[model samples]
Target: GNNSGNLANISLDDILNERVKELYWEGFRRSDLIRYGKFTGDNYLWPFKGGVLSGQGVAAYRNLFPIPASDIIANSNLVQNPGYN
Candidate 1:
């Protein structure tokens, strides 16, 4: 119960690791990494991130989920998300 450590001493990496440990199964990892600017680019990567065994930075547009093809087809005004179409 003694969570009195100085928050300033906590590194971003520590915070990210803790979030991963605490919220791994809740599906927040992607969003968390994205919020920390680690979801794209070379800042962060794990095994198979982009179907590579060593991991790799993905395109920036990957940060947003792609609009469904069906939805775009149904609505001519709807544009497929960049990098998805």
Candidate 2:
């Protein structure tokens, strides 16, 4: 109930670990990791990142989803996101 005492001394890593346990399968992992600046770069790598067995950092632009090809073709003004093409 009263977690202030625990929160007072908890580190970012501790909070992240706890979040993973508490929010498993809730789809918050990507946002959480991005908020903590661990989504990209080699600082944090999960299983099979970039198709590598050991995992590896991905391009920074990978953070944003690419626009669909159909949408771009339909709308001349619709530009694809960076790093997609």
Candidate 3:
């Protein structure tokens, strides 16, 4: 029963924003952005796991992962995510 034919005007951003609203606190943003190629680039890098960072140096550009706040607080050797601190 759909008409108007305006559905094609919808963009990925529109879909993502809606999904973000629905899943905001459920911890799905990271996966969604990465799968959609919305994560990474000049402004975004996933956080490094503090345990890994403590065992290894701050990850190189190619090796980044999300570290929960608790992990960072537990490991003094671990560095916070670049932009977060």
Best by TM-score: 1
Off by over 4 Å in 3: 1-8, 43-85
Q: What lDDT tens digits, residue by residue, belong to model 2 across residues 1-85?
A: 2555534466898889999999999989889988888888899888998789999998888788999999999999988898998
Model 1 lDDT tens row, 1-85: 2378546466889988998999988999889888989999977889999889999998899899998888888999998888987
Clashing pairs for predicted structure model 3, backbone only: 47-65
Q: For residues 6-77, write the lDDT of model 3, one tens digit per residue.
A: 565777888888998998899988688668765654233334533343332332332346577899889978
In angstroms, the error of model 1 at 63 is 0.3
lDDT of 3 at 14: 86
Best by lDDT: 1
Mark the 10 consecutive residues where model 2 has the least summed lDDT. 1-10
Error of 1 at 32 (Å): 0.5
Better structure of 1 and 3 per TM-score:
1
lDDT for residue 61 in candidate 3, whole number 0-100 = 37
lDDT of each: 0.88, 0.87, 0.62
The lDDT ranking, best first, is 1, 2, 3
Q: Please give the distance, in angstroms, between residue 20's alpha carbon in candidate 2 and its true position after superposition.
A: 1.5
